[model samples]
Target: MTVFKVFYQHNKEEVVVREHTQTMYVEAQTEEQVRRYLKDRNYNIEFITKLEGTHLEYEKQSEHFNVEQAE
Candidate 1:
């Protein structure tokens, strides 16, 4: 079985896919069919994994401030 690391642009999430596995597998002969399958299923990567594809990686949207400049 071949393993592929899928990456999402929206949330920057990643997921691993394998043959005959039940992890959002899109099987279609044509590109349109595949697209339709994904769209119909509304499949999305739940969590983003690191480059090693072993652990989940999360990023927080925080603001950084400089205390010295903040008078």
Candidate 2:
């Protein structure tokens, strides 16, 4: 298995809340698997913000790790 760094955003719709960017380290064979793993960890897309100007996004880091680790 390979290690992946997943970058995602979590935002709240409150009046005085800032958007949150989160990172996750996942061990999977493919990027799709990383996404699935994140979902299983309760990072579902429904929690992401979908505002008109700013929308939450996620991406797999270009750097790969042989071991599992996260920040």
Candidate 3:
């Protein structure tokens, strides 16, 4: 499994802003797996970035970098 940072808007009708967007970390085998694991909602998906190497290391420094396991 790999860690991914998903940026999305809670409301699909609202315009997506980088600053206003919400983020979550998910563990999944693939990008498709991550997408499918998310709850069914009207989410304005922004970006899904796979974190590894130095990037993953950097994120670990933050207090908010909690990984969510996908069932």
lDDT against the true structure, each candidate: 0.29, 0.43, 0.89
lDDT value, residue 11 of candidate 1: 27
Residue-level lDDT tens digits of model 3 in 1-71: 99999999999898878888988899998888888888576788899999999999999888999999876
lDDT of 1 by residue, 1-71 (tens): 11222233332233434332232222234434444434533345432222223321211211321111100
How large is the C-alpha RMSD of every model relative to the true structure? 17.6, 9.9, 1.2
Worst 10 residues of 2 by lDDT: 48-57
Clashes in predicted model 2: 0
Runs of candidate 3 with Cα error greater than 4 angstroms are none
Candidate 2: stretches off by over 4 Å: 11-19, 40-71
Q: How would the candidate models be sorted by TM-score, starting from the highest?
A: 3, 2, 1
Best by TM-score: 3
State TM-scores per candidate: 0.25, 0.42, 0.89
Assess the local accuracy of residue 5 in candidate 3 as a C-alpha lDDT between 0 and 100: 94
The deviation in Å at residue 12 for candidate 2 is 8.6
Better of 1 and 2 by lDDT: 2
lDDT (Cα, 0-100) at 28 in candidate 3: 92
